[model samples]
Target: MSRSLKFALLITLRGFSWYIRHVTKSFLGRGQVPVIDSDAHVVETERTWEFIDGNDIRFKPVLASARSEPNNYRWLVDDKLRRRAMLSDIDHLRPVDRNTQTPEDAREMSDIQSRLNHMDQLGIDVQVLHNTLFIEQVADRIEVDVAVCKAWNRWLADIWSKGNGRFRWSCVLPLTSINDALDQMRFAKDNGAVAVCMRPIESTRTLPDIYFYPIYEEAERLNMAIAVHIANGNSAVCDVLRSPYDPGASFGMFRAMTAVSCHSYMVSELPQKFPLLRWGFIEASAQWGPWVAHEARRRYEASGKVFPDNPFAEFRVYVTCQNDDDLDYIVGYVGEDNLLIGTDYGHFDPSSEIDAISILKSRTDLSTSLINKIVDFNPRNFYAI
Candidate 1:
């Protein structure tokens, strides 16, 4: 059958399995319970999976211009980079539809239905939505960029606002101009954005470029944390992987890995100059945290004395760790305060919010207090929720 029908069938099967597990756990009294503390008792449910799946939804924005480029796929080649610059192509990367509905129209409902079913199976609370590949779409446009940003932001608020207070959002900004970006930040805050998202590629300039200070200031003013993320194959690093010298290698496998290294370098430098700015690197994976911290510290110790104006002074940058053991090392280096959890769920990954929570709880070396901080507290503290 078609992709849409396949997804629908999968959702139905997953939902049925989830109901069985939910009833079985409640009947056997094998449900997870809340931990009590001096301040409050945290209650978990056997039906927690159902609640999480039912409540949490994913929102992905599409940029209409990113998919139109002739050399879009070939842009991965180094020689083609010059050709891409000359073409100045822009188009939206359309999502694959399994049915007659447009991807944008169907993505939220489909993702919510699938995610809710998975959440019921996994016992998660909720998931905040983010865009798929809009970052790459807006990277090159300077003129009329604000309009494109507004279009995506308005669509997200309109479609996902019915989720009561459970649905959260990451807003898109027009970074071509600092003034325009500041206005967009205000617009996003008024429209219920939980965080502001941008690419880490420095397409216009480095994150610390003085031109963007007003944008950072606006984010801090609105109490929304800045999230720097990367769409696959949007940077020069991806070109290195697609080189003829390594034709057998897959481009998709190395995109995030390469972007994470580039992002670490950018993060190490941005915070020192904008010390008040709270930032998180999303979709960059949790494993790189310790190395980033170690490298930043090493470089600072070696040259910090010589360059007193450096931005890496006692820096405390926050990062979202995917459920993994590398988080154990990241927390050891950055401390519990700097780590948060994100499953990058609601996509191909069937793991739900509960699965992420279980992973967090499974860290026996970590205290209940620490787990609570990672699961709920850190995000609230960072986003000022």
Candidate 2:
């Protein structure tokens, strides 16, 4: 046999093996519910800003690294350095393993097919990609914000087009400029974004502030969920909460803010105001659901109002749960239908659970139906995935 023939045969066998594995995993479990990773992340790469418009080229974000420390990277945006430029920047947490089961190109999503293959391995039928850069404020200037957000949305849209419906995203907007934000939301909705990303505390405004009402109104009109991912747009708050020695203490700022957002929204009746819109409190585990619900109930009573038996259901709100969370208790406040789960794919924080779907399934405390809702039905209903 010729050496060239042997090489071709080897390639053929590898391709055939991949096909068999993919088909067996996808179709063999026809009766089983498909898993949707509600909060997977896409680590930002230099390629992310390539979609910036010609006129906005001046506002393009520049990736910079120190000469002495090769891995000390940050994004230079509007003459400022954003330390958390990429998931890998937080090396203390060991954010992501680029060359592990997932390839670097796949994790950053420069190669969409490779990412899909990794998803297949993880049993994630669809991954709702979130932005790593936009977790914190990318730019203080409105022009920069608008330009950068437009570019990011366009980049995600292109990825979605090539993903074969396996990648949905949460779109970020220039909240400072409501008009530009609305336009971006429309573009995102027309493309493949299932939700709009918001922080619990966005700059000087909180989620319940009327400043965000316009964004909420537009999101509802687009039939998109307001996904309040664990983020701190307020730099002052971040500074106060950040601990030099403890990464968990620093990261707790984001989790606490998201929980506060949920509580604030419930008390403010923001969800009721936007009746048609769905609200998602993600990454921050659902254990806080009962606490927030209880606090909201007390605030309602104090204000001479009657709190509903299930605020989450009444408000069209959903929250993500971790495998370690007490779902049996959280369910009593959040209700089964309003609970979802996620794998914080690219980041290695406390919430990061690459095998969350399988782990949740193994919980003997939860019934099969409830587990299915957390992994499948709830996420599909929340993000319309």
Candidate 2, residue 13: the lDDT equals 62
- Stretches of model 1 off by over 4 angstroms after superposition: 1-107, 110-122, 232-240, 243-272, 306-314, 349-354, 362-365
TM-score for each candidate, following the candidate numbering: 0.62, 0.88
Global fold similarity of model 1 (TM-score): 0.62
What 10-residue stretch in candidate 2 is worst by lDDT? 15-24
RMSD of 2: 11.0
- Global lDDT of each candidate: 0.49, 0.82
lDDT of 1 at 198: 63
lDDT tens digits, residue span 1-385, model 1: 7542353344346433533443234533655432111000011111111222222211111212235753543222111222122111222321232111112212334344543444445454444567643434333445445554565566556535653343457777767766777777787788767678766544535555566667777776676767665443245544555667775433243335434544454445555555555666665555666665555556767874432322222343566665644655666666786566765443332112324556667878778777877665555545544
- List, residue by residue over 37-87, the lDDT tens digit for candidate 2: 898988877798899999999999887777886677788899987855653
Candidate 1: RMSD to truth: 14.4
